[model samples]
Target chain A: MNCQDLQRLVHAYLDYELDLMTSLDLEAHLNECSACRARHAEMRALRDLEARQLRFHAAPAPLKARIARNMRAACGNDDARRWRAWRAATAVSVLALAALLAWVVLPRTLPGPHQVVAQSQEKMVYHIANSEDVATALRNVANLLEISPDARIVVVANNQGVDFLLRGARDRDGTPYEPAVSRLKVRGVDFRVCNNTLARRRIDSSQVIPEAKLVPSGIAEISRLQTREGYAYMKL
Target chain B: MMPHVDAAYNLAWWLVRNRADAEDAVQEAFLRAYKFFGSFRGDDGRAWLLAIVRNACYALRGQAPGAGVNEEFDEQVHLPGMVAEGSNGPFCRNPEDIAIQHADRELVNRAIEELPVVFREVLVMREIEELSYKEIARIVDVPLGTVMSRLARGRRLLHEAIVARMKKESPK
Candidate 1:
């Protein structure tokens, strides 16, 4: 092939998209051509520069935690349901019955919510998965407090949701959301985050915003709030 | 959630162009992928996961300025004035030249952010993610020729933008 033909095919060759015959033809042309060879060299160098220089942000801690925790919880539930179905299809052995009875009689996995102060009439648990979720939860909290200032509302942020409680966290436009968090805090709304998610994400305890408290697990906390605290649950 | 989280994150980051939105997009995509995991039939799990991410990114309300749910790739509108590959001048940042001067990723990132949405994605798939052209074509749902043209044009614009930024940062 000629220099002009080789020029168009250089990218294809570099990308390994060229067919065998075309690659051989380009190699033959490269042996005799100076300018085409120089272009080829430059393309390789640029590709190298790109590989070394480009930066990528990892799947940050909270999101990673959210996925892992949600997946595990979802899978655990699905597996239990599936196992029960399988067992029902077959004969229910005495050993299976004993195991089922043991689970039913055991104490709850999460700690019971304490009646720390005067109990409010309305109790609600807000689940926040993203910063925007936090926004929705906060708006709901403010609206709820407007109607019932003495209402007991708890916002539980876990997984990627902990980002809302991160210090100096910014919205998509780089606007800080800290003042809004402070406003919610002053109104007696409680904010709790999942420590398991935080630990797995490798975020230090200090990274958490001042207004939020850490819980052992998000899923467990949500369960505790719903079952033990008599709180209505809303996930944003 | 899959072995492809890194690849998935990279694709979303390139498309959404920010940490918070990209994280949201990836989280939503993984949930969708997990929900539809049984329906997956391809061996290219990374590409499949990325297709979900691309969809999730578009579904977000006000993702980036140009990203939309139904992204139509029209080559005729996008293929004008591609720089000649053999030409080497100010528009092209030669590796030898780039090495001599300091190069910051933020400048390169800004140049990428400014491209037409489709061109930016194609370039990102090919150059950053190192996906094959066929894989990119599958993910973007365009023909092979469209992929080639966009990639070439995207690379052309990216190189020009990088060189332009370098010149502005440290004038010769």
Candidate 2:
């Protein structure tokens, strides 16, 4: 192979993509050509630099948990339903009696929702996309807090949802969202606004109410809450 | 399939160039994969997941308002001798200077980040992920020859960009 031909095949040769015969030919050319050898070395150096320096972003723990949760939710429900259907279709009289007995006994033995909540800290995330969403989120949070005063709640706002969090912003009836936000804040409810939307809409940080915290992205916050923090998600 | 999430996330992160969008792309890709999993007959699960992640990244880019345009590769613009023979050639410098340049993580990262998405993707697949050229071709949905050329061009561009940055950063 000639020098020009070697240049074309050099990366392939470096990558081991060249066949043995072709690689031997290229190696032979490299021995004779100092310029091609230097070029080859340069490519090798660049590859090493990349391997050593370029960051490989691993999936975050929260993301993995989120995917697992989603997969379980998607597949588990379908599989359970399918199994139940198959059992119902194939069951003889004795199996039907056994299944009926199990169904009757299972509910009494399993912990109820209230008991489950009492055993662990109740955590919830509310995704708010607009003004109305904020209203509904506030109501739900208030009710949940009344039920479980120590429940952890976070309300995430993006897009037009952030409008209510801004100072001087009001609801349709000219009622400022600040008082309700403050009430929730005192009750330990966290509020977050998406900084991306804030920047896109040209809203300054100072414009946001004191009760609201600025997050890098609202959707990311919601995902993190659900996956990493074990918070139940509610989109209003 | 679950073990490939990190690989999928890495590819999606490089393609989309942002954490938020990358996460969204990965989530969407996994969801799609789950939905159409019966169609997946391939033995290499990582390659399959990465292809879906790449598609998801592009789909997210399409939805983004005024996303940056990927530059076209022009062979004539990047003639071979231009960088190799220059004062800033990789081997032209002393060993210590070369070492220092490579150690600068931000410089290397910025150089790769500045390349157009097409070249960047191929470079990441080969250099970072260590995928074979044929595997990269399948994941990128391009001809094998196209993968080789893109990898070559991407490395050259990356090398030149790094050298230029080192030259600019060095004290006179």
Candidate 3:
């Protein structure tokens, strides 16, 4: 609590940040030190002079308005609610335009279902509803195309194709297609059942082929694959 | 909150040294504080705002072509406040007293402004703003020891500048 110590502590003392004992000790040092006391007095005087001279007049009303305008210009408009609504409307319009173009161009882009069986190179995919002999129909198509028994074929069935890919609750003749289909999957020929058809026919997903992925809207999915993915589609 | 605002304005005024510029800086600091409020979790809020003000000032410096770019400054001559409307007696009592007060304030301001930006900022925050050593360190993004040392150096420089100006003004 000497001269140098008191000088250093002036800032801390003015701030009233020191604890009681430290404050008392500093006060004791100040009482005995005249030079330090004068230094402290000068510092306080300087601080007071600064505070008085540095008076801040509030920004004039016009200046505040100009600054607020400048801030908004620099940072972009802060109107979240208006921007959000505008964004939503723009998105909806874009989607609607896309759907309209797809509808207008779809028919011209695709070959007929019967033409698909004849012109396909590798194999043709057939999505059958409910037919009495879907397997026979598929075998005929495969033979006509001179496809081997092991050629890659995808059968997407609702009630009809589901039973063909899986079981029909009763086996077709003495031949059960599920075991043959499972063995075909092992050989890489894909078989899938339509979940949409299964739902319509009141059949559960488990009743279809276990390996089959349930396409939600089977007809739209079939068209999508043909138009979008270059897959040829055929009718049995 | 009021004290912190006062402290920040004092520091800003000392740095920019114009009421208009200081007011703009403080307003910008408040807006920035609101925008980045989420990021400040465990810090002295006042120090954090001052740090943001420091950055804002720098941003304004770069954006505006010549603001804060030049340390050398010339005081603007003031317009005569009152003049006799018609061909009357004198040019309204000379206005020398008012002019002197304005000149003294401007001299002090210019002295502060003449310091390098870093030295001026540290001095203003520590002395005029009355921030703690730790708060100054945080605001300036420097070490505590550095803040203490800089505060001492900055004060010395300011005192020297004021004394030199006073001596120049007085008769030799």
Candidate 4:
């Protein structure tokens, strides 16, 4: 093999990805050519140096422990539900009796209006165009939802959302709520702001929540969240 | 949570480099994930959590851009002394063994952090996490070829950094 051919195959050969015939040809060439052999050795040495240096620096143990803790705290309540289910399995007879009594004693409960609307899956993120301050847009949505200090609503706004935020009215608290539109961040409800929208609005990263990341486009991110991630967007 | 903890921690570790930062990022990611769990559609919970980790790292850095860029190394130094005081001794196996193990880890992490933000992300996903190129492309919102090219370049750069470091350490 010529020098160029040998060089081309060198990386693949090192990785053992070269086909048998090509591998043999390269091997033969290396045997005959001192320069290629030396070159190959250098590459091999470089690869070895990298492997040795490729340290698994354990992430700070405290951090690992913390993540594990939070994830547990995050997922802990879930296991409770499972335990409840298992208990229900063992006490099926008691549950049946309690259900019968409850059914006879209480009036049938109907779903609330907001609950119906919330479950509709008809939420569409309106692409508000060319305004400024998406965080303010989110704060506006929170206000529109009449988001109180303790009450949080999922708000996903991106580029156009910025306009919506800029135009958003103050809550009863009289505080201008800057909506923190994160693409997949939900403080308790999912909210996404478009990276594209932020760009269109000429807002830099500082204006938005660090949690609010730049997705490709606000509208597309919204659509994907709704269809792929199952978030329902509502225009307030 | 138990099952996913290791994976989540690993991903966070890769992204933030520093343990404290990684922990902070992961914890915040979990909180955000939990609050947003209702929004999760399919089962790929790991990826969803990782997406949150990515955001958290951004958030941490956003809090202090200057600090994040420095990639604090002193945090690792306090570990050995802390381990001695603590009951677990150390989850890092043993101290002498870690010296060798940590050598490579430090290099990998330093090299990774040195990479451009875009390339560092792809390398973390592809190499550390072993994600598919397509999946990485989707997460980073780049094209497949861009992902591949970035991965190749990232590896090459990582190799270059490692070799340089080794040369500096070796006796002349």
> lDDT of each prediction vs. the true structure?
0.66, 0.72, 0.53, 0.50
DockQ of each: 0.12, 0.16, 0.03, 0.07
Candidate 3 chain A: 10-residue stretch with minimal lDDT = A87-96
Give the range of the ten consecutive residues with the poorest summed lDDT in model 2 chain A. A87-96
lDDT of 4 by residue, B50-160 (tens): 667677777787743213322233123332222443543222222221212233656656766787665577665654444556666666565665565555445545555
**What DockQ does model 1 achieve?**
0.12
lDDT of 2 by residue, A1-236 (tens): 87657767888987768988999998898898776777777777777788679987888889989997886687577554443333232222222332343344344553332233323356667788987677656766775564346778888999988999999988753668898899999999999999999999999999999999999999999878755665656666
Question: A185-229 in candidate 1: lDDT tens per residue?
Answer: 898888998999999999998999988999999989988876676
Candidate no. 4 TM-score: 0.40
Ranking by TM-score: 2, 1, 3, 4
User: Across residues B34-93, which tens digit of lDDT does each residue of candidate 3 receive?
Assistant: 555545554244567678767666565564412342223211211132234343211223
Say which candidate scores most in DockQ.
2
How does residue A166 of candidate 3 score in lDDT? 56
> Given candidate 2, what's the lDDT at residue B49?
73
> What is the lDDT, from 0 to 100, of the residue A89 in candidate 3?
25
Show the lowest summed lDDT stretch of 10 residues, model 4 chain A: A87-96
Candidate 2: RMSD to truth = 21.0
| CA deviation > 4 Å runs, candidate 1 | A1-7, A77-236, B61-102
Query: Which has the higher DockQ value, candidate number 1 or candidate number 4?
Result: 1
What DockQ results for candidate 2?
Answer: 0.16
Write down the TM-score of every candidate. Answer: 0.52, 0.56, 0.41, 0.40
Report RMSD (Å) for each prediction in the order shown: 17.8, 21.0, 33.0, 23.2
